[model samples]
Target: MIETIVFDVGETITRDDRYWASWADWLGAPRHSLSALVGAVVARGQDNAEALRLLRPGIDIDAEYQAREAAGRGEALDEADLYADVRPALTALRELGVRVIIAGNQTSRAGELLRDLDLPADLVVTSGEWHVAKPQPQFFERVREVARAAPSATVYVGDHPANDIFPAKAAGLRTAHIRRGPWGHLWADDPEVAAAADWRIDSLFQLASIAKG
Candidate 1:
């Protein structure tokens, strides 16, 4: 019996493409034509500095989003706010008696986003709070500790293989990789993660079905 469902906010439960599109639009770039250089910067382990030089350019990435929100042009700039149709799935999970938790590299903005969407989560474990990123086993171990999740009773659902699947696997948790997204590494694609995943799904709606069995 799966007791807890851990979610990766960006591409797993939320629609990250729309958020990327918003960023491209804010930068005055064609949404489709904007070079996916963000991926390269992330792969190369460059801080937001390189990404700013190429994409944001003299704009404070965080401040710009806040400004947009202040000007009423943005609702919530955080992943929890920008992603779509997540609350419903979370509600469904709760209805099905699954304890839901969020694990991501987000600021405290996650709490506001969840409150805005009115989603019910037992806890949210973020990278900022943990001081570690995924693909590092310590991250998952910390989340497991907070959620008190048994290895056999919990699963991690995320879009990236390294950040989402690898660390979770190393931490002895089952993993579900969400397909179809612009995650940093093409190597994190679902087919690749599926080769090692205990389960796989294209969307959060499919999670309950996958977990029930």
Candidate 2:
């Protein structure tokens, strides 16, 4: 039985439209241009942040983030940013006695913002808080530790194949590949992603059934 359901924030629980749009505005670049670059970077298996660097070579992303914040524009999330199904799906899982957690490759401020939303989750955390990011075994180890369950009893759900499905499967957890965002749709039909994911779903509502199983 799946006792815990851990989620990736970007393009899973949340749509990244505003997140990337904000970056485009900050860099004074056309939003469509940056979005296209992000998709291209993902297609090449490059980090999505490479899109920003392509916009401004040698750009210090971390410093730019700090500067954006100082200038009154930083990471922002609200109820509107959430997927339409997020609330209902999470609430349903919790009602079913399934432990729901939100842990993703997000910043500490993003974590705080997620917690502030008060979603029906046992915990909300981020790579910035844990000092580790995904595609790394240590990240999933932290996930298992925080889940307080055997790896097999937990399910990791996300849209990214390399960062979400592959590593989580390697960690011995059941994996759900959600086809929602760029990476999700782009790699959804890949032979390896299909093989790695224990479940392939297009909607968060599908998780209710996975939890029950």
Candidate 3:
């Protein structure tokens, strides 16, 4: 039985098109260009930050982001940025007495940002805090260790099959693919990605059904 459900923050539990679009605008790249670049990077089975930097070179990411946060634009996302299905699904799973975790490979402060949002997470962690990103055995190991969960008893939900699904599967956990965001929908038909997931659902509402299974 799945006793723990770990989630990827962006796209899976949150919709972030506007989030990336705003950054693209701020960085003087066309919104679609940024989006396409991200898709291209993921298509190559690579992380998207390198694509962002490639699209807009020589900009100090940390400095620019810090300055923006200092000026109150906020650090990437707020509680309002979450997808509509997130709250109800998380609430449903929690009501089933399942342990829920929010884990993301995101900006250095993403873990803190998620924790501040009053979201339904018993634990929130990030690659920034752990100094390790997904697709690495250690990252899943961290999740497994902290949740006090054996991988077999865990179900990881994410949008990116390259980074989330395959790795989690290798770590011995089941994976659920949610097709709502860039990478999710972008690689929906990808052969490897299509085969990686044990479950596929278009919305978080489906998670409730899995909670009872």
Candidate 4:
């Protein structure tokens, strides 16, 4: 039985993949290429701050950099609304006896976002909090520790293949790739993504059926 479900806040829970577009414009790289680049950076053990520094000049990394700064200072910015139906989906999952945990690189931004949505999650595992992001095995390992979960009984639902899918698979957790928000195109084109994910759902609501199995 699945006792815990790990979720990625941005894109997966919140409709905020717009950061990718900002990233692309800031880095002057193609949006898709930036997706792969961020994956490669994480794979190489580089921090997001260092990655931003290495990126070319004239790119406005301000929004992202500012958000991180705000998080560090414990300030909340109203970027936009968290994804619609996120509260309902989370409430439904909890009703099914599934403890929901957030696993992402978001600093305190995710927690603030969830709070703003008025939805309560059981646990939040963040790279900023843990000093690592997904696709790196340590991210899931840290999450498992925080959630007190056994890998086989937990499922990670996220949108990124390199970070979300591959690492969760390696961590012995089932992976559900939800493609609809930002990185929707990345999910469509990433070759390694399909093989890494155990299940693909277009929406969070679909997890109810998949988890039941």
TM-score leader: 2
What lDDT does each candidate get?
A: 0.69, 0.95, 0.83, 0.69
How accurate locally is residue 125 in candidate 1, as Cα lDDT from 0 to 100?
58
lDDT string, candidate 1, 39-158, tens digits:
666566454236546765677767886877787666354444444557777878888888899888665655456445545787765676677877677788887886576887898888
Q: Each model's TM-score?
A: 0.74, 0.98, 0.89, 0.71
Give the TM-score (vs. native) of candidate 4.
0.71
In model 1, the Cα lDDT at residue 79 comes to: 43
In the range 1-213, model 3's lDDT, one tens digit per residue, is 779999998888667787778788777788989888888887786877767787878868778788768877655667678988887888888999889999878766767778778787788888888899887899989888876777877999999887899899888888898887778887777788778888888998898788789
Candidate 2 lDDT over residue span 1-213, tens digit each: 999999999999999989899999999999999999998999998889999999889999999999999998988889999999999999999999999999999999999999999999999999999999998999999999998888998999999998999999999999999999999999999999999999999999999998899
The residue ranges of model 4 lying beyond 4 angstroms of the native Cα positions read 17-80, 189-191
Candidate 3, overall lDDT? 0.83
Better of 1 and 4 by lDDT: 1
Q: Which stretches of candidate 1 lie over 4 Å from their true place?
A: 25-28, 35-53, 56-85, 184-192
Top lDDT prediction, candidate number: 2
lDDT of 1 at 32: 63
Cα deviation of 68, candidate 2, in Å: 0.4
lDDT of 1: 0.69
For each of the candidates, the C-alpha root-mean-square deviation to the true structure, in angstroms, is: 4.1, 0.7, 2.1, 5.4
lDDT of 4 by residue, 83-154 (tens): 666767778888898888877878755556555655558875567767776667778788777666688778
